[model samples]
Target: MTTLAPTEPLPRFAVFGAGAVGSYYGAMLARAGVPVVLIGRPAHVQAMRAHGLRLQTADFDERIAVHADTDAAAVAGADVVLVCVKSGDTEAAGAALHPHLGPQTAVLSLQNGVDNAERLARVLGRPVVPVVVYVAAGLEGPGHVRHHGRGDLVLAPFPQAARVQAALARAGVPTTVSDAVPQALWTKLVVNCAFNALSAITARPYGWLWAQAGVPEMLRQVVRECVAVAAADGIALDAAALDADVERIAHSMATQMSSTARDLLRGHPTEVDHLNGHVVARAHAHGLQAPVNHALQTLVHLLEQGRGA
Candidate 1:
């Protein structure tokens, strides 16, 4: 029996680089009766193929029946491709998918960094929707994801956005398709700039940082600089409410380690260049100063260099 959405046939999805974020969303879509194929690593594919995808959220725990693969060729018939690799892997991931994607496939960049969509479009010679992911989940193990809280997405408007948003919302993924997505992406970038490096450098969570003296003020400076860069890029961020939003985010996710922190912990290269380093690069391009971001980027670079030493 073919299941149809309210107005259209549910789109087949292929989650590229299905790590924590990709696997979780794929699981959600599968649970909603949308066909999805998770293209991830060998271990994940093996586990999922054996036992299904184990998804544990705050509200529920279940194994979803979905397809899993380790090849980019698995995306052949997929209507949508969700890119979920790290910021540094955007170009390579795009290259891997270049020969596989259909002309009409809707590519969505679900990773961090505000410029990812633009980068991907350049690499693939096609448009890619930029998505701001507001989710707290991690790969607990192979083929397993433990969701802590918040599973929502804000996406740049595209021609197929209406159908996509309807499917996502029906699948319990809160979504908003808007024109303000550029600013929204910058806003999330601002948050990442403020916390990711510091967290990686200190090897601590937000609570530990909040417990430190002067850390809050330092973070404030970081956000202020990122906002300036965003303004220079013509984003016009909500300057008045920016501080409150950062504070709320820090306190709310106090126990969570920034993704950079996790990468450094695992001795993998962190996305410092894309986060704080990105602000510094753009600031220099505009002849603006971003000393705080520079310092953070430098420190993270040192950590990267010292890894395995």
Candidate 2:
């Protein structure tokens, strides 16, 4: 991991997918005077290029100057490229952007899923930072991103991370770099594994989901399975801390249905494979059973297929 001097210039930003999360971050950075380009679908690109990117957040509704393009080549001159595509598209997106990445360019996997950075790294043949996104956002329309609440970043430690952190802080996005980011990612994954599937299956919010009879027991089962898998994978999480973290999600965003639920509702692909599905695979490798996670993944797949049918 390399550290940079405090006085260095901020890197230019490119967002590979100008969807909800990507557009919000790119627009925020662009508003802060960091050059930002967003690559996405043609309609979104044209809409944003013509009318600028519309940001509707809890605090403000503003339009910002961000270059929106459909061309992957737009990432060519960027010093930092954020891979914001859906988890399933990580490899293909990395491949598409590979020819444009310079030796000095830094790529960050800003999408969900714990393994996206590693998957993208395999395709890009470089170290890509894994960013744990703490924001809730949705795309309301073409070129418009509606930010529900919260926008802080927990970044994995990397050679250029501190410099990136400082620049993001200057851009008003709270940034924290941590050596224990894998732990943090697993922590988020555990929460998601417990909540996302139920939210999708029932189309209910966390608070409502938790209040239902048997829901809490189901969550405990899910968490227990996840904890067993994590331990078998050699992660050092204690029981007390894990429960507290799980409780925090119920307390904080209790009204939230996961982005996966929303994705399913909108007919977009959900990231179950990266969430609970990852747990199932890890359990297999560890000689442990993850029946709860396996059931959740299987259930979500069935729901998706039912919707398709």
For each candidate in the order shown, give its overall lDDT on alpha carbons.
Answer: 0.90, 0.86
| Alpha carbon RMSD to native, model 2 | 2.3
The TM-score leader among the candidates is 1
TM-score of each: 0.96, 0.94
The candidate 2 region of ten consecutive residues with least summed lDDT is: 1-10
Model 1: residues >4 Å from true position, as ranges? 1-7
| Per-candidate clash tally | 0, 3
- Compared to the true structure, candidate 1 yields what TM-score? 0.96
**Ten-residue stretch with the least lDDT total in model 1:** 1-10
Count residue pairs with overlapping backbones in model 1: 0
